[model samples]
Target: MEIQKTPLKDCFILKPDVFRDDRGLFYETYNQKVFEKITGLKIDFVQDNQSVSSKGVLRGLHFQNGEMVQAKLVRVVKGKVLDIVVDIRKDSETFGRSFSIILDDVEHLQLFVPKGFAHGFITLSEQSIFSYKCDNYYDKASECGIIYNDATLALDWHLPKEEFIISAKDLELPSFEEAIS
Candidate 1:
């Protein structure tokens, strides 16, 4: 696996060496030794989660605060999505910065979002199946979110607002400023 650093510190794009044949294809999605060597970070994933969303559906800008914060390794297993990660580390140089990539089944690319970042995505195909590994388990009390359309961040979803659909919880999320404060 190769780790490509993103604009935000500690964030990475991981490309695994895929072996293909007429039968199908195989790739080691997560090897502890290889992952630690490539990213120089040791993470003990305690939980795994999956979600499926239809085109135009957006889920995100979410994170867990305090000690519940988690580092995530995410990838799409079907279709495509515009995956995003925003740095929210208070003392980091790249704090408030964001990075995005198109994750699809074809590329099989995975994104590493460090603990102090908020993550989200917008489906770009008819349906998308996404999965992720987290170093920490879900903690409802610590969960928090920033509005996907927070003006200061001005994230370009690459889709018209009217065309997009969001959950009621996502629609009620606070702005970035409110999240930070």
Candidate 2:
């Protein structure tokens, strides 16, 4: 697999080596030993979550706080999305910095989103099947988020604001500044 580092301290874009033949294609999505050898991080993903969203569906800029914080290996299973992550680690040099990438079935790319970051995605195809492996189990009381359209962050969703179909909860999330405050 090819591991590409993002500007964010511990974020990465991983591309697995694909083997194709006349009948099908195969790749190792995750191998604990190889993953640890290459990334130098030992991750034990306890939960595997998948979601199906229609075009324009914007999920979040969300994270879990304290001991509930999660590190995720996210990818697209059937379509495409604009995946975004922000470093929210207060003491880190890259805190408040954001990164974006296109995750789609075609390229089979995956993003490694570490803890201390807010992550979100917008469906870019007619529908998208997004999946992720999380290192920690979720805790509702520890759930936190920043509004996707926070002016301070000024992230480009690659679509018009009117086209985004966000949940009322996400729409009401606090701004970046408010979230860190």
Candidate 3:
């Protein structure tokens, strides 16, 4: 497995060594020792979540701030998606900056979105299954997000604005300017 850094501070892209054969394929998705050795940060994931979305569906720019910060390892399981992460740590050099990547079943690539970043994805295929591991347990009070189409962030979700199928809750979230710092 190789853990590569992303443009944002404390975040990374992890690529596992996939072995293929006549039967099928195999790979190790998580190994605590190797991850800590490579990134120098120890994580104890407490939750695993998965969601299915159709093409043109946009999920988030969500974060858990305050006392219950959550870092995530996100990947595509069945199809393809445009994954986006935004740095929200006020003291970091890359604060407010965003990074985008293509995460699909074919590549089996993963993104490590650290505690202080907002994470989200847009489905690019007919149907996509997205999975993630979270370092901390859920805290409803601390969960919040910047609206996906925040003008300041200027995220290009691949699909046009009118094409998106967003949730009513997501639509009601604050813009970047109003997001928690």
Give the winner by lDDT.
2
Return the TM-score for candidate 2, rounded to 2 decimals: 0.98
lDDT, residue 54, model 1: 94
Candidate 2 lDDT (Cα, 0 to 1)? 0.94
Runs off by more than 4 Å, candidate 2 = none
lDDT of all predictions: 0.93, 0.94, 0.92
Model 3: lDDT equals 0.92
Which residue pairs in candidate 2 collide? none
Model 3 error, position 158 (Å): 0.7
Model 3 superposed RMSD (Cα)? 0.9
Where model 3 places Cα greater than 4 Å from the true spot, the runs are none
Compute each candidate's TM-score over C-alphas: 0.98, 0.98, 0.97
TM-score of model 3 relative to the true fold? 0.97
Local accuracy of candidate 3 as per-residue lDDT tens digits, 49-152? 99999998999989987889999999999999999999988889999899999999998999988888998999999999999999898898988999998989
Q: Write the per-residue lDDT of candidate 1 for residues 1-181, one digit (tens) a residue.
A: 8789888899989998999999999998888898889778999999999999999999998999999999999999999999998898889999899899999999899999999999999999999999999999899999999999999888988778887989999999999999989
In order of lDDT, best first, we have 2, 1, 3
Better of 1 and 2 by lDDT: 2
lDDT of 2 by residue, 22-114 (tens): 988898887778778888999999999999999999999999999999999999999999999999999989999999999999899999999
